[model samples]
Target: MQSQWGIMHGTHTTPVGRVRDGALDLLKWLALLSMVLDHLRYVGLSLDGLYVPGRLAFPWFCLAIAANLHRTRNAVVTGHWRYLGWLLLFSVISEVPYRMFIDDADTLNVLPTLALGLLVARGWQQKALIDRGLALIALILGAVFSSQLMFGFFGVLLPLAMLLVFRRPWYFSVLPGWVCVAANQWQILLNSGSVVALTGLVACLIAPLAGLMLLQYAKNVSPPAMRRWAYALYPLHFLLLLLLRKALA
Candidate 1:
């Protein structure tokens, strides 16, 4: 059977079967909300504690990418280019607000890391020369921008790792979990007093498997509306947070 996007579903199961899992959508929004809360700590409050909740964002996003990959299995390889294009566009658009909101933040921002992650995942999925080239570019950019973000080069690699172990047994995800933890410098930090940090570290380790399992079991979700205003949400939310912070300050 085929869904509205003309992609096959309920047939030819991959590691995870084809389905429109609502839980994945729920996870994405939850992750997005958690990320916003984490950013709010920098903008309005010193709730460094909120960082734990924020940890959900990246992994959930990675899972979303995996879900998209499963859904678009039939699309031409070029279909992924459009997805990367949207991510790149958002990354550029969100740069100013991201920098403005987070003190001492590098301008490249999270979207670039995600874009690179997509390239790596697609390259691994399709094994194309262009995809491999794009992944290389992402890696180079991550290296160049490493000083700005704590996660740096490892962040770019996290999604690919997630894709690699996707849908395997829970224990199998540990390899990527270790990589995710290392990517975020989990062991190096000594935030012993901060439950947020500890929780975030643990979540980072488990998010891939959790996300994969969720997508594997659930179904009946709709894609987000693609109105132009929808894309503005990324930057606009930051502006709103900035304004809220200023008012409270």
Candidate 2:
């Protein structure tokens, strides 16, 4: 199956001198913006309406992960380990800020979910038994701790779904799109039936496909790269928001 990005099946050739993808950076920035908007709802303001756009954040982030895995499909294992390591490190580092900011937080911060999702996506892309085993373990953990995961089990599945349709037709993204909705508690949104809740539901349903379109067609116009240091932003944002909330009070 050939794609516009030249994805060849059963090809083991590593890309040479791979340049950074600006579209990915753009996606990351947009995701970060959406996340900030979502978190802003907690800033002692009556901004509940922001929830609609906020629905886009997590799915876009999962798309970024899928893009990264697709790009590094043939890279060395050490590099993949490094990626997972940063996520794990920040998962621990970010917990305090996450708890401090979020009221009665029931779930771990989002990074652990992403880290597990990464393992699952890697399992799908790789032929290694260890990778597959790790992915299985991740799935089990996601299942066992669904209540303790920010987006729950479906969130852990979203990245793998994104990876499956990464370079495929745009319509294929609906799989992950629905997964995104499920992860965000679509049933509750549906039950609410308010305009904002409905809008948020729609946003969650389409976010993955929309993000995929951006990745496929958006120009790589030298957007800022989101690197390892970007991990700090997750925890830092929570702290900043806590300060903002306190100041507003």
Cα lDDT computed for each candidate against the true fold:
0.69, 0.87
Error of 2 at 62 (Å): 0.8
**Which one wins on TM-score?**
2
**TM-score for each predicted model, relative to the true structure:** 0.82, 0.94
The TM-score between candidate 1 and the true structure equals 0.82
Put down candidate 2 lDDT per residue, 41-81, tens digits, no spaces.
99999999999889989988898888888877777777788
What's the CA error at residue 36 for candidate 1, in Å? 0.8
lDDT of candidate 2?
A: 0.87
Candidate 1's C-alpha runs over 4 A off are 1-21, 191-193, 220-229
In candidate 2, which residue pairs clash?
none
CA lDDT, candidate 2, residue 82 = 90
Q: Which pairs of residues collide in candidate 1? A: none
